[model samples]
Target chain A: MIRNLQVAPDHYLLELRLPAEFPCPEPGQFMMVRLRGRDEPFLSRPFSVHNFRMHRGSVSLEILYRVVGKGTLLFSRQSKGTILGILGPLGRPFRISSICPTVVLLSGGIGVAPLAYLAHRCRGRNAGGKRTSIIVYAGARNAQSIVGIKHFEAVDLRICTDDGSRGFHGPVTALFERDLCSYDPEKTMIYACGPPAMIGSLARILEATSFSCQVSMEERMACGVGACLGCVTAVKDNGGRIRYERVCREGPVFDIRDLAGLKTDPC
Target chain B: MNASGTFGFGEEFAPFVDLNELGALVVKGLSWEPRQGNPPPRIIETVGGMLNAIGLENPGARAFIEEKLPFLRQYDVAVIANIFGETLDEYPRVAEALSRAGGIKAIEVNISCPNVKKGGIAFGADPDIAAEVTRQVKTATDMPVIVKLTPNVADITDVARSVEAAGADAVSLINTLTGMAIDVESRTPQIQNVTGGLSGPAIRPVALRMVWQTVKRVSIPVIGVGGIMRAEDALEFLIAGAKAVQIGTANFVNPQITLEVIAGIEGYLIRHRMDDIRDLIGSLIEPDSLEHPHEP
Candidate 1:
């Protein structure tokens, strides 16, 4: 661990320096982290990669987390030298096809962590001659809850706070609704990660739209691996039949359209 | 073997593990009909363990035979179908369904699920019902029958004996113990289900003791389960008289843990100059039984 600092109230950004040979995680892939030598919180907590840098002899990855419960509260007090049992790059990552000319990244609260990495990757792809534009819509309860805004500096940024303390006074999806005319729905792909309510509303708004969208879901996960079957989300198969899919394995990232009538409550 | 419900019919971890290397693979608990399971917040991490209330959610036995069994048939691993029921009659029906499926190596009667409202732990909690379920399953199938006993019972040996008397080929001891966790600030249960089954390192000691007692009391082989995260934990169970062990909660932490455990046990046997791993079974020395015991 190198840096552990508060990026917002109750939220902290942790930078872990892993071995040079550590496999790099793709955008939207998450890591399961637990404090070394602690079993009070028996299972490791999952966190999406916020940023990463592979240097000459080391690889450092950043994780943005909030003190939502016991495991995270312990994470907030850890110092730079604390050892954490890390399991990684788990779950399916966000898929971006080159055919899509525009990518819309939407996030709520700490969900911004993975989208930040996704935005960075989009910028890198664009630099490599792929004609793609990036737009980020970030929403939070208040200014203090806003996170990862700086990572989206190069993209068109739209910020929304529920209390009207930030850029857009309404929900972030409203901005996407207002800007719907700017891009061709056929050429655009929207990726969202956040509270179920926010994602649910976004899904509802996109019902009549033709833009393809993917959502990164959050569930109370015990094992960030596929074995547990603890973190499952209901998804519709090709036959329009519902089946419980493990979020830790098959995906935390899934096509919004594939989720037929997803429940608004956390699973 | 990977315990029921932990390995999800053996398809999810196929990329991470070699199913052929396992002694057996116990698929998730199958029922007469598809079960939606408990509501959200079905699992939560506790001190040195985790609690789950999955309620045995499955695609039903017919769906299992159609969708999952064929995939499992590709592997050399002994596939054990862990069957459960919502009522007494459903047990034989589930077993008979698997019996006609033609590929399963054995049938594990799951009379130990604590998450359901009926016909699960309730059946395992009593000796007569446990025996009846075991007898019905045994009559319904020609495959080897293994009765998985719940640790939630007053005396697991009683349940073990009943299953043994009912002609069960073997028994799997120590299913998850019923437990609960509360969120202080929210002033509510952490899991949506008021109570859940606890399994992990925290429950290992209790499971071992139960396995030991059951081993001493019954004539059948015991498959020890509950928090066998490492090879050493499994060895403890083997020494205490378990014929085999099942890896459960630890599979969540590390998908390769089962293979690691197999390697570790092999290493220990090689270090001890043992040709066969069976030599270590029930090899514990009882200090009290020795004629000239050292007073410490």
Candidate 2:
């Protein structure tokens, strides 16, 4: 581990030195992390790559997290020299296409980590030199909860707070809805990751407008690899039949239309 | 052995550890038809363990034979297919399907899964029911059948002896103990199924005790499984008369645990100047049997 920085109240940005040979993780892909040699917390927790960068023969990635539970609480207390176990670059990554020249990254609170990486990657590739326009809509409980927006260097950043203590005085969904008419739905793609409630609200809005969107889901996972089927999400096949697909395998990122029943209570 | 349910088809751990190093790769519990399993939150972590109500979800027997079995055929590890059923009739059919698949070295009958509503622990909790399921599965396949027994019973040995009487080649025990956790704020159960099977280091002591008792009762080989996270844990079971040990929840903690455990056991044998693992198996020296019990 290289650095563990407290970026905000109860939130942190953990930087770890990666082997140069490590496979670079795509924005939406995640890694399972746990305290090395500790058996009390039997399973590793999954975290999306907050930021991935290389500089002067060194490669490191930053993971953004909040101390919400025992696993994250213990992770927050680790020092710079603590060695942690990690299983990486697992699950399907967000697929960016040329058809959608305009990409909208929608995130809620700490869910902004992967979206920040998505924006950074798109700007780096210049969307394969197609002049892609990038926009980010970050929502949180208050100003203190919003995080990881600084890495979104060259994109349009919009912030909203539920408590009306930040940029826009409402949920991020409402702000995005008001500006929905400005972009052409045919050329725009929306990517979202957040609390289930926020995603539910966005799903409702997108259903009415019929814009193409994909959602990154979070589930309590035992094995980040596909071995344990502990992290499955409800989804509809092409036949519209509902089945559980491993979020750690087929997704953490899935097209909104493929979700079964659009139920807010993720199983 | 990578315990059933914790290890997928063994393909997931291929990148981290060589499959040839494992004693056997026990795939997830397979049903005649694909089961969606219980609703979530199906899993929750406790102090030193976790409760899971996965309810035996899988791609079904046909899917395993057609899609999953091919990937496992490349490996040199012994493949043990763990089969279960919602009904007694489903048992033989699924066992026959896997047996016909050709690559399977053995079949592990799962009558002990605690999460399901019927045909899992229900069959396992009763000696007669467990024996019936074991007999049916055994008759359907020419391969060796090892019956997995549940811990959520008055006496685990009753079920073990029953299965042995009915022609089980070996027996693996104990499956997760029935447990539940509640969220104080919501006043709701942490598991969607109200109760789940508890596994990990928390259940190791109880599991080891059961294995010792069952080992004494059944003449057939006894395979110990339940929260075996390290080499010492595996050795403890072997000393208690278990022929072999299976790694369960520890695979979730570390994918390379099987290799580590295999190496650790070898290292201990070398240090003790033992030539064979059979000398270590069931080699426990009771205090009363020793001349000076207190002397180390």
Candidate 3:
């Protein structure tokens, strides 16, 4: 059972009880949730474990939805006692360099989930007072999808909106490009997760730059675990050739250089 | 086996099954070492069947022996460790590791993995390589080695005879046939691994034909596999000259299928007064047996 369901209007903060036998999920790992009482969609949908408290047998998932489909609308209305069929924390996680003193977390809307975990992990580590600062450039269509702003008050946060309804009147990538010019590329590593447009735009922005980058992605996945390679990406292999990789297994997190195109697995 | 990715080990299916009733528990294919496997979209579903390109993911021989073996110990089923590898050397090493584990009753060497791009041509493709690899693994372990032939080959009989000559104790057929599916709107392949191994009801006819071909070519016992969804399907394998039968894609649909199939086979046997199952082995319309009805 997830201990907390921190509702922030548009998004539901779901906490899941991680079974003891479950492999400890890393920073970028995601889980598949089987929505009950819904028959239209036949399979489970994958979600990243936004934050984990493995010692306490719980994982916090940030679900940012607009209550559209039966799956989402049904999930949003469910009571706390709901017992869902779920399997995870599937897929590979992001790798944070212990030596990096500064890092940039790029996200748009709910893409913040996995990055939030990365930031928390950096903060979780009992480093000898190592100064690690995470700068987030998060965006959404408007304020609703970006509702979890209050949670990161202590961390540096920058918000963006598409229609000038919020912080910057553009996608998160635009602001990221402007700020990244001054940020030390040698010392700062970028971690991003968001829609394909944002991720693709950021990839274009950072193509010539020296900063190492990884992006957490989303696709219409049935089995959130690697068993179903429904969420695969085209990664450029060693010989400059592209091959499919399951996001649920190889990564929700992957080096930007390895990605051939900013595309998700077909639904 | 678990048809590559459809099933893991026998654990998930146990709740709905009395595993001991299974003639042989063929676990999923394992490699010499651990594999990260191909990236997501490894599996896809179709009407009445499914396809997968799990890339034969397993926890290498070491972890399989160390961590997973314990759960399978109490079961009375014949545990066949299906092994696969990239090269010839890896096959023996995997067989030796599984043999050393002790509980695994036999080793089923899967030679037809098409996902890999290098090294050996799929084991069932070339009779010489198939025979060579079979020789290496059979010599490496004391456990009976069952060479699992693939349907993708043109002449499965050549490889079947080759492996039998190479000292394989028995053989199993038809591993999943290679196939694919696509997503129309975006015009992209549905599986992350663009192509996947096709299994389930769709491949039953193809699988049966290949098993029959191998059955006639080899002297050893044949274990039939592929799209076996019902008791009748298992009966079909027995009637087609298989010594034993394995449930692959059917386990993904109904976990209790192994027991369900056994019950169905026993019920069929009772109706026919076929008291001993061993007598049914290779009893498929024996051309000479029909002329002299009661003669073996």
Candidate 4:
């Protein structure tokens, strides 16, 4: 552990010095963390890599989390130099389809962690050398819950809080929906990560559109690897049959249309 | 040894674990047909353990042989195939299929999966049915048979002894305890299946007591399972007469746990000045037999 800083109420930004030989994690990939030698919380908790940097020839990882349960509470109390058990870079990364002209990054509360990393990747030009415009819509329950905005270098950054203490009033999804009129479906791509309700709202808004999108999901997991067969999310197979896929392996990021909840035909 | 379901066909942990270091790799319960298993919210973490209702989802016997078994064959570990059925007759068929595959060293009959409706715990809960399943599998294959017993029964020893009598070469006890947890705020069950099999450190003491009981009742070799996280935990089972120990939930926490446990057991032997592991097996000293209580 390098730094453990409380960025907001009930939220923290933990920095860890990754092993020199550790592989670089893609933006949407995650790490499973547990306090070294602690047994109260038996299983490790999965956290998306908020941001990472090359520090003194080694990788430095940042994890943004909220104190929602026993595991996060324990993580909040730890100080510098406390060794931890970390299982890395697991799950498939977000695939940027084709040479898109614009990328929309959406998030709610601590969900903005991974999107910040995505935004960092979006800052540069695409394979065709066409400059890609980046836009981020981040939201939270209140202003105190809004964080990680400074880490993003997006061309446009919109913030929304439930209590109206931040940029826009009401939900971030509402702000994104209001701004959706100007985006060209052929040139734009959307990526989201947030609370289930927020994601659900965004999914409903994009259900009938041709806009390409991917959303990251969260679940309580025993093993961050696929072996446990735990942490599964409902999704439609190629045959349109609803089947469970491991969130840890198959994806933490999936196309909006593939999720079973958004399937048009009810089985 | 890794308990079934906790270790997937052995390929998933290859990056972090050396499969050859394990005593045996027990694959997840394979049925006659590919099963999708349970729905969402299949697993939930409790105080010290987890409740899972994965419902024995696997790529049937044939698929396992064609796809997963080949990957496992690359590793130099003994592969124990754990098979189950929804009906009584399916047991022999699954066992016969795996036996024909040639790589599997033993067949561990899983008549104790609590998540399923019909053939799992139903057969294990009754001694006669457990014995019948064992007898049928033994008749169908030339491989050694090990029947896994459930702790969700009135008496695990009765099931153990019955299976032993039915020609089981070995017995592994005890499978997870049937358990459930509720989300008080949501006013609903934490697991989608309502009740799941609980495995972890919380069930260690109960599992230890049951393994000790079953060891005394059965003449065959007994393998202790359930919530064995550390070498000390495995040693407890060994001292209680378990010939082998299987680590389940701990594998989820650390993939290299089995290697650490193997090293820890060796360290214990060296510290105690014991030349052989058999010296520790069934070494439990009763209170009345304690000659040097303060010598340690």
Candidate 3 structure quality by residue, lDDT tens digits, B69-159: 8888888877888888888899999899889888988888888876665432366689999999999998899999988887787788888
lDDT of all predictions: 0.87, 0.89, 0.72, 0.89
lDDT of 4 by residue, A86-172 (tens): 999898988875677789998988889999988887787673357888888888888877888878864698889889998999888
- Candidate scoring better on TM-score of 3 and 4: 4
lDDT per residue for candidate 2 within A56-81, as digits (tens), equals 87889899998888899889888898
Interface RMSD of 1: 2.0
Q: What's the true lDDT of residue A221 in model 2?
A: 92
Could you give candidate 1's per-residue lDDT for residues A1-267 as a string of tens digits?
788999889989999999788789998789988775555775788999899888788799999998988899988998988888888888999998777878898998888999998988888564224568888999999987898877786788889988889888877877778988887887788999987777877887788988899998888887677656678788888899877777878788999988755545421
**Model 4: pairs clashing at backbone N, Cα or C within 3 Å:** none
Best by TM-score: 2
Candidate that beats the other on DockQ, 1 or 3, i.e. the better one: 1
For model 4, residues B1-296, the per-residue Cα lDDT tens digits are: 89999988888898989899999999999999998888878998888898999999898999999999999988889999999999999999999999999899999999999999889999999999999999999999999999999998888999998999999999998888999999898999999999999999999999999988888888899999979889999999999999999999999999899889989999999999999999999999868535456754
List of clashing residue pairs for candidate 3: A2-A15, A229-B40, A229-B41, A229-B42, A229-B43, A230-B41, A245-B39, A245-B40, A246-B39, A246-B40
Rank the models by DockQ, top first. 2, 4, 1, 3
| Chain A TM-score values, per prediction | 0.94, 0.94, 0.84, 0.94
Residue ranges of candidate 2 with Cα displaced over 4 Å: A127-129, A261-267, B289-296
Of the candidates numbered 1 and 4, which has the greater DockQ value?
4
- Give the clash count for model 3: 10
Off by over 4 Å in 3: A1-267, B1-5, B11-21, B45-51, B74-76, B119-121, B181-194, B263-296
lDDT of model 1 at position B159? 90
Between candidates 2 and 3, name the one with more favorable DockQ. Answer: 2
